[model samples]
Structures are given as structure tokens and as C-alpha cells.
Target: MTNYNAVFAATFAAGAGVMGMAQTADAQHAGHNNGMSDFDVYASSEYGFCDAKKIASVWGQSIWEGKMTLANKVRAGLTDLADADIASAEGVRCDWSEAELTYADATQLASYWGNSIEEAKSKVADLMSGMGHKRFVETFADAMADQTEGDEYDVGGNFETYVASSYGYCDAKKIASVWGQSILDGKLTIASKVSAGLTDLADADIASATSVSCDWSEAELSYDDAQRLADFWGNSVEEAKSKVATRMSEIGHKRFVEAFDYVLR
Candidate 1:
């Protein structure tokens, strides 16, 4: 549940399978994105009238909040909150399953676990030092998922960045100039070709600083997926990659941080 790559990639591949060769140029175009997987990842446009830059402002707001959350969590001494939260949340998310649990039920579960939502959330994990790990696991069943405090939220969308090169996909060029500068400055002088390539396009629209939102929305983590992630822990392929971004930051990896560092900066 914590691996960024495994968590999000599994969701993406599961939700939107490979596009395969299309029949027409236009249909091929919608396959791009704005939720469509086009040949480019820089997000040119999709469905004919899509605008990549229009949402720049929104992404910026998201980044601000994300950075603030990370900062606040650190201050609260909940350095591992995101990981635990994401894993527990993912473990019990409501998207892919039909278990009678409404969106309200999800939020309510958070409340039921404790007086304050944060305290209640902390109650979600066994690793959590508080009073409720075993209870949380038993009550939520095997469905709910939450990221470990060990991981941070990662932005795994923007498919163009990862689509294999042989296909000539578009990559986001926005320099992550705002987010994680120190990491980039430490070990790696430049980013990988795929990331570096997107720098120009991501910068073309200097709307707002963008940070990753819930990369793996509750919609993506069904009960079964959450169960699998929790069961695998660090063992399986999908469970581990699910939270790469957070782990990268935790392990303080120079290479992984380089991926999102330039997007906001």
C-alpha cells in the first residue's frame, strides 16, 4: 500500500488498460489525456477541446497544500503519518468495491476510531503506538487501506512521463523547480531524460506551483487491493511500488526525489 509506483501503477493499469493501436487519428487523440492516454505525457490536449494549462492554477494550489501537509506532519512529530494514513486509508478505500459503505461511511470510520479525526486516524495501524491497531484491523476488515507514515504522497498521474519511449510519448517539461530543490542539488546534477524532456512543457504555463494530490484516490483502492497491499507489506511487487514517492523521501533517495522536485520549483 505504500509503494508509490506499485500503488498508483496498479490502479492506473487496472482502471485504464493499455490503449493499444487505435483505428483513427482523432480517436487516437482522445487516447492522449486529461484522463485520456495520448502519445504525449506533457498533456497537450485531449477530446479535442482539452486545455493542459487551464488547470495549472489548480495544480499549484494542490502543491501548496501538499507541502504544507508534509511540513505540518513533520512539526506534529507525526513524521510517519502519511505512510500510515495512506496505507490504512487505501486499505479501507471505497472505490472499486460494492460493500454498502458510502463515501460518508469512509469519513465516519475515521471519526469512529477516535475523538479527533487525526487521533482516530492514528488508531488505524498496528505499528501505531497508541491504543487501537488490532481493533482497527478487525473492524475495517481486510478492505480499507492507508499509506504508512513511512511514505509520502506521490504524483503518479501524467502518464506521458512514463509511457515507454519507443512510442514517442509526450513528457511534461515543467521543471519541478519549486518542490524538492535540495535533493536535486545533492547527488544528481540533472534529471533522467524522460523527466528532463518534460521540463519545457511544464514550464510553458507558469500558472501555479503544482504538487501531487491524492495520487491513488480512494476510488482506486478497493477493499481487495487494500487487502493485497497490507498482506504483502514489503513482499509483493504492486504493494511496494505503491508508495515509492514517500519511501524515496524517507530513504532520501537522490534519484526518485529528482522526479517531482522540478515540477513545482
Candidate 2:
């Protein structure tokens, strides 16, 4: 079997600018066990070569960094060991862990995909459906390290935060529009509609929604944000709006119809 302990020891030594020919034979044949019981078993199993390579790269880097606890390194090392495609795509010599060593620098990716980190992670996670939670955390650790510096498990926390942000069945605009139209359609006076729509909403959302609700306003959904929404929903603006409308309460839809008739008067 290939000696992964020696391989990682060399890689770790290289990162620290240390190299000794004698250390090679020593690590390979004579080094004491470092308690990698699972890794040893994994390296000896069928199809362990590629998986061993991936784990060693990450494990070595974690060791060289000398910041993470040993347990954390072992936990981190187990990630991304099964993604043959990701490894192949990266390079003959590179896995996701290796790629991340240089940093994927996901800020640019995030910017290209969406307005926020949460949106970026959502889009990425959708595309990488097979990626596990541990692998995802390890892969995006650099981007998150900067965003949530000073936390021990910032990357994991950021991952959870992004996933949570991606999930709401409704968005601010959908909620506001439904509520606004409902108030407008109510038996209550016109004054009540405006007041209700404007209530508890941020000035920015209200301003934008008002522009959307009032056909006369030149300020529509800005091209960039609209494009982002279209990309995220994978639908045209009209289609997305229609979908949002379907998700509204029946009373909310009825309110929109009543409000439309009132406006026609």
C-alpha cells in the first residue's frame, strides 16, 4: 500500500520550507502512529489510492498551517475524498483540497452569481448537489474565513447561515405586495390601504414596491437586480411574478383583484 503518512509529512514539511532526505524513509517506515485509525483503513481498502491522495493533500495542508487542532485536521481531511470528478476537473495532481490551498477566492464567484454571500452559496450548493456538508465547508472556508473571522468554526456557521437564508418560501417583495394589495382591496378606506402597505416595511422596500405598484413610475426593478432574480429563479420576470402570485393567500389574490378594479375607477 502507498504510504500516505509519508506523503503528507513531506507535503507538510515542504510548506514549512523544511526538507530532509532522511525524513522520507523515517516517516514512511519507522514513524510512530499518529492515531489516524480511519485513514489507515481507508488507505488500505480498494479504490483507496485516489481517496488517499485527496485526504493527504488536505491533511498535509492543515498540518502545515499549524493552527487547527489535530482532531479538526482529521475531520477536515476526511472531506472531498470521494469526488473523482472534482479531482479530475481540478487537475491530475489537484483535488478540491489542493485547489483550495491556493484559495478558490469565491468573492468573485459570489459577485458574479448574486448580490450577497448567502445567494452565492445557495447557487453553488444547488449546482453541487452531491457535495456533502463537510466538503462544502472545507471548500468555501477561505471566503467564509474572511467574512466571519475570529470564529473557530466560522466556515461551518456560514454554511448553515447561507442554507437558512436560501430557504424562505417567500421573499420580501412577495410578502409586501400581497399585504399591500390586501389592504387596498379591503372594505376599509383608501387611506387605510396606503397606511397598511407602508407599515412595518423598510423605506427602501416600500419605495421600490411603490414604484412597481404605480405604473406611472419610471423606477422599475433595476436591470441588474432583475437579472439576478431571473437567474436565481430560472424564469422570466413575468413568470417569476406569476409564480409568486400563486403562492399568495386566496384573500391576497382577491384583494389584488379588488384593488385593480378600484384603480380602474
Candidate 3:
């Protein structure tokens, strides 16, 4: 046998290396008058390989001017220029300068916006337009932490809305965690439970029922039992119950929670 798989893999790897070298050569040739080094060309090739067209476009526009470090960072996937700034560079005038963000800021902004460093910076810039650089940095950090710096009611209101929409209390907790709130404490309250559509079940009893197995749909649920079932299914107790209710209702069963009432009987 000719071992076709091994041969194909080797051929693909060689082709990729050749492609990288060719792109580097092209970048060098294009920027010959600008004194681009072999390393710069290699970095540009890597940037292109990463599908960072915007950064590549900006590099080409600047003719490698003041961009060696930024290009290296982009090639390494450590940071990227802002997208809008790159677009501005690609325009006829081509006066867009380098991104003003640090590597950490760029990385965080990229994660927040789920976009290239360039785009994230532009969005962040717009968001922090009126603030000084220090204020912007501090505000960005606070925003990521979900803290409003003592802005009362904003976090709670948002959490309440998230819980009420049947998204589950855990998800609400995650949101609240970002805002530095203890959502568990908030959700444990009677008003919060009712608002989230959760039935009042004793937490201790729910803790005792984890090993018990029965047809959940037909069983009566104490608060404890419901909580255990919710945990088992990776949902909020209210969400688990709501799903059961919806399923039973679909099958023409009215009073859905009552379907589980037989456990008590």
C-alpha cells in the first residue's frame, strides 16, 4: 500500500509553508522602497494567514511605516488594530494611525465585542468618548466586572427581568455575578421566588431527595424534590417545573403542577 494519508498530510504541510514563503516574498517586494526586513515580511505573511485582512490592508497602506511592532503582535495573535481605524487607512487619504489600546485592553475588547481588535477598539472608543484615558480604562474594567460603582437598582432590576423571562435563576446569577451582586441571596427571598415563578419548597427536604428516583412527571414535588430534579436536569426548579407543565399541557392535561401532586398522596 502507498500510504496515501501520510503522503497527503506531508504534501499539505509543504504547500502551506510554500504559501507562507510566497506571501512573505510578495510583501517584501511590495514594500521594497520602505525598507521592510525579512522578519517584517514573515510577520505580514502570518497576519494574512490568520485572516486578518484589515491589519494587512493597513500595513500595505502605511508601506510598513510605524507598524513593525503592531504587525508582530497581530502575527502572534496577541493583539490587533481596530477595524474602523483600518478602514480609515484603506480609504484614499490613508491617515489612520495605530490603535491606542494596550495588549490587555485590545484582548478584553476583542472578547467583549467578539470581533477583531480593530473593531473592538472602535466600539470601545465610541463608548468612552467623553472620558479621559484613565477614566476610560477604569470604566472599562468596571463594565467588565458588571459593577456600576454603587449604581443601586440597575443590577437588581436587570436580574429580576432576566429571572422573570424564564431564563432560569442560575443565568440571572451569572449576570448578577458580573455586576458584583449575590444573586443567590436575592433569589432566595419569597418575593424574588414568586417573581421568578418558582414554587416555595423547603431547601432541606430538597437536599434529602437527591437519591430518590421516580417518574418525575407523575410524582408530587416538595420544594426539595423540585430543586433536586432541577439540579439533575441542569435547570432552575421553576424552569424544570415549567417544562413539565408545558409537556403535560400539550398532552391535554390541565393543572400541570398537580400532575406531580400524587407524590404527596
Q: Largest lDDT belongs to which candidate?
A: 3
lDDT per residue as tens, model 1, 154-221: 22332323332211101111122333222111111122343567534333321232332223221112
lDDT of 2 by residue, 1-265 (tens): 1222333333333332111111222233222245433223222222222233333344443111111122233445543333433243232242222112111234445765555644554444443333422355455555444433333243333222212221111222333353442211111122233235542333333333432232100111122323444566789965644443442222232233233333212
* Model 1 TM-score on a 0 to 1 scale: 0.20
Q: What local distance difference test score does each model get?
A: 0.28, 0.31, 0.36
Rank the candidate models, highest TM-score first: 2, 1, 3
**Runs off by more than 4 Å, candidate 3:** 1-143, 146-152, 160-265
The lDDT, on a scale of 0 to 1, for candidate 1 is: 0.28
Q: Candidate 3's residue-wise lDDT over 175-265, tens digit each?
A: 2333333333323232244455553332222223233222223222233545655776689977876665444333211123334334312
**Count of residue pairs whose backbone atoms collide, per candidate:** 69, 0, 11
TM-score of 2: 0.21
Instruction: State the local distance difference test value for candidate 2.
Output: 0.31
